[model samples]
Target: MRNYQPATLKKNVRLASKFAYWLDCELSEMTSANVEDYLIHLHQQGRSAKTIKNHRSAIKVFCDFLGTRGILQDNPVLRVPSMELPEEIPIFLTDEEVDKLMVIARLDDMFCEVTLALNTGLRMEEMRRLEWRDIDLKFKQLTVRKSKSKRPRTVPLNQRTCKALETQRERYGHLVYVFPGGKGGFYNRGIWTEPKMRSENWWQKLSIRHIQEVIPSLKNLPAGRTGRGWHDLRHTF
Candidate 1:
C-alpha cells in the first residue's frame, strides 16, 4: 500500500506528512522545483516565511525517513533551496522593566511565571509536559522529558524554581502534574482548566493586561509578536 497517513505520525511528524500530502508529489519526485512549488503553495496559503521554512524542513525529514525505509533511492530535501530568514534584533528586558514586573507580581500567577522563565530555559512544551514524578527535591533537579527528540534532560532547580514548585505542590496536591489538570484530565480548556507542568500563561495573560493597563496608547495596540514575551527573562541568565 502506497499509503501516506498523516495522522499516524507523531505531532511533528503529522505536520511533515501533511506537507507531503498537500504537495501531491511522491517522495521520489522531490526536487528543487518541487520544493519551490510547495513553499509557494504554503506562502499562498497565508503562511509566513518562517512557517514556510518550517514546513519545508518537516517535509525534508519525511523524505529522509522514507529514504531510510528504501521507499526512495535519494532524499530530494538535501538539495532544496533554503529560505533566507530576515535578521532580528535581540530583545531583553532592562533592569527597570524586570523590576517593574516584579513589583506588580504580588500573588498573581504571572509572577511565578516570570521567576521560572528567568530561572530555567524550559520551553512551553516542556512546561506543559512536566510531571510530579520527574521532580526530585532530594536531588535538587527537575527532569525534562524532551518532547521533540524524546530525550531526557535534567536542570538544577534554582531557589526560585524550588519555591514555586513547593508552593504549587501545597496548593494543588493529588493532581499528579506540576501545574494543574482540567475537569477532563489533561484537556486544557483554559486558564481555569489547562494541563500544565509549569504554566506561565497566567503570567503572560496578566502581563499583557498590565501592559495595556499601564500604557494608554498601547491599550488598543496588538500584543507583542516579534519575540517570545516570557523568553526575555529566560535569556536573562
Candidate 2:
C-alpha cells in the first residue's frame, strides 16, 4: 500500500505477512518484546543480517501504521537496536579483465548483450527486455523500458557498442529480441514472454566459463557472496 516499487512492495508485504503468521496474534497484542522475539526467530532460522534487517524494517513500518490508527502507544521497532551489517565494498572489473571478457564474448552469442552492459550501465533485467526497436545505431542511443526505477531512460551508445549491435543485428535481426534465446523466444521462462529477455544467470554462467578459461584462479573467486558478476561490467564502464 505504501509508495514502493513493485519488487520492493512485494518483499515488504511478504515479510509483514510472515511476521503476522508467526505471531498469530491480533494487532493490539503485538508488542516491542514480540518484535524482538521475531528477530531472534529469524536469526535462529539462519537468515543473514541484511535479510533480517529487511524483515525488521517491514514489521517496523506496520507497527508505525498501527500507531497512526490509534492502535498502539509506541513503535516497537524503536525499542530494539538495528542489526549490525557487515560492510561490503562493491568490486568493479578491471579494464584488462573486461578486455579479456570482451575477447571471449565476441565469440559467444551474448557478445552484443555484453557490449551493451559495458557501454550503457544497464542492469541485467534491462538488458533482457531490450529489443531491436529500442536501439538506434545511427544515433547511438538505446531506450530502456520497465527499469528498476519504474521509469524509461535512454542510454547513449558508444562506437564499440553500436558496432557490436550492428553485427548482432546482421545475424539475429529476424527475431524481435536483440538477444534471443536458443529457442527463438525469450531467454527466461515466465508467464509473460513478450520479446522475452535473456536470463542474467545464463550470461553469468557463460561469462564465468570464459573468465576461468583465461585465468583459472578467477573460477574459484566467490561469485554470489561479494564476487564478480554481470553488475561488475556496469561498474567497469
Candidate 3:
C-alpha cells in the first residue's frame, strides 16, 4: 500500500507471524477476545506499552486485510484501546559535545553524515533514503521525499553541511544513493531481515551503534532514552 513503506510492511508481516505463532487456534478463528488476551500476555511478559501497542497495530492491519479477503468476518484488534505513552523531555548534544563529536567523526570518516544530520535535522531513515539527485548544491538545499510525515520538505544547507556534502559527492557522486551500502546499493541492505541472518552490508547504515562507538559518552546513558542515539544530532540542530 502507498501508506506503508517496504520496511514497515516487512515489520508488520513479522509481527503477524509472531502473533500467529503465539495463538493456539487458526488465524481465521481469531476474535477480539484473543487479541485482548495477547495484549495481556505481552504486558505480563514485561513488554513496554509502546511495544505492545505496535503489536496491536500490526495485528490490526493483518486482521483488516483478512477481512477484505473474506477470510474473516470481523477484525479482532479493533476493540483494543490505543497505548498512551508518557511524555518525556528530549535531550540534545551540547556545543562542546558537538565540537568533540565532529572532530571524532572527521577522523572516523563520518564527517558528512554527522554534519548533514546536525545541520539538516534529517532522521536516520530519511538520510538512508537520500539520493544525490535530491540535493542542489548550487542552491544549498536538499529535499526529503521519504519523510515519516509523508510530506516532501526542503532543508536549507549551511556552509558546513555543504562542504561535508561536497566531500561525499566527490567520493560517491556516480552512485544512486548519496550514502550507498558496501555493494553500492542503499545503506543497510536487508535491514528488515533478522539481525543474525543479515549480510555484512547491514552495517553500512549510519546506525546508533556506530554513533555510540564514536561517542563513548552516549554508551553509558540509559537505554531507550532520547539522547543516546543519532536523533540527538537532529535535536542539537
Candidate 4:
C-alpha cells in the first residue's frame, strides 16, 4: 500500500479483501479450489460474465504479485477454468431520456460532468483526475491523459457542453474542479463511489443521492435499471 500509487493500491487491496471474504481465508490461504469457488460466488450473485472476467483479471494480477513475494505456491487463478461470456450488443439510452435528465438538472456541477460524459465519453476516473488546466477552453476541447486503455484521447466540446460549462462558472471556478464536493472543490477520496448510470453518490451520500429521488420522471425510463450505472449515460452517447 505504501509503495504503490494510491488508486492502484486501492484496487489491488479491494480485490484481495473480496478474495479473503469469498474463500473465508486470508491471502496466504488462497488455493486453486478457493479461486474456483470465488468465480462460482460471482455467478451466484448475478454478476455478468464480463464483470466476472474483469474481476478475475484483477485477482490474477494480485495473485501473481503474491507468488513473486513467495506468499502463494502458484497463481491459483491460472488453474481456474476459462469462463465463457455471452455476446450481447451494447445497450444505450434514447436521446429523449438524455434530454429529460437535462430538463431536471439541478446540480450545476453534476450537470457539467453529465454533459461532458454525454458529449465526450470521458470515464469517471478520467473526469475525477481532470484539473482545470486540462480543459482547453480556447479550443473547445477536453483532453483525458489516460483512459481505460491507458491511452490519451481528446474530445471536442459541442455547443451543449459549452453552455453547460458556462452555466457552471459561478458555482465552480477556473481552478475548482468542475464537479465540486459538498463544501467545495474535489471530493475527498474517503467514501466516494463511481457515479453509475443512476447518479453520483446515488447509493450513498444523502445530499447528492437525492438528485435522482427528486427527478422521478427519469425513474420510469427503461434504461433506469438495465444500465443504471452512470457510465451507460456515456455509453448511450
Per candidate, the number of residue pairs that clash is 1, 0, 0, 5
For model 2, how does the per-residue alpha-carbon lDDT over 95-146 read when each residue is reduced to its tens digit? Answer: 6777787776655545677788888888776777788899888898989877
Q: What is the TM-score of candidate 4? A: 0.70
User: What is the TM-score (0 to 1) of candidate 3?
Assistant: 0.81
Error of 4 at 78 (Å): 0.7
Clashing residue pairs in candidate 2 are none
lDDT of 3: 0.74
Give lDDT tens digits, candidate 3, residues 168-200.
Answer: 888777777777655322343322322122222
Error of 1 at 99 (Å): 3.6
Error of 4 at 74 (Å): 2.4
lDDT of 4 by residue, 1-237 (tens): 345544556666787668766667778788888878888889899987877886787688788788889998889899887788778665455766667565534333256766777788776667766755567767898777767666778888888887777766544554445554443212432222222222333312322233354445334333333224456567777
Please identify model 4 stretches exceeding 4 Å from their true place. 1-12, 21-30, 41-51, 107-109, 183-228
Which has the greatest lDDT? 3
Per-residue lDDT for 21-72 in model 1, tens only? 7766666766767877778887888987877877777777677777888987
Question: Largest TM-score belongs to which candidate?
Answer: 3
Give the local distance difference test score of model 1.
0.62
Clashing pairs in 4: 196-229, 196-230, 197-228, 197-229, 197-230
The global C-alpha lDDT for each of the candidates, from Candidate 1 onward, is: 0.62, 0.73, 0.74, 0.62
TM-score of each: 0.63, 0.68, 0.81, 0.70
For every candidate in turn, the CA RMSD to the true structure comes to: 6.4, 5.2, 5.7, 6.4
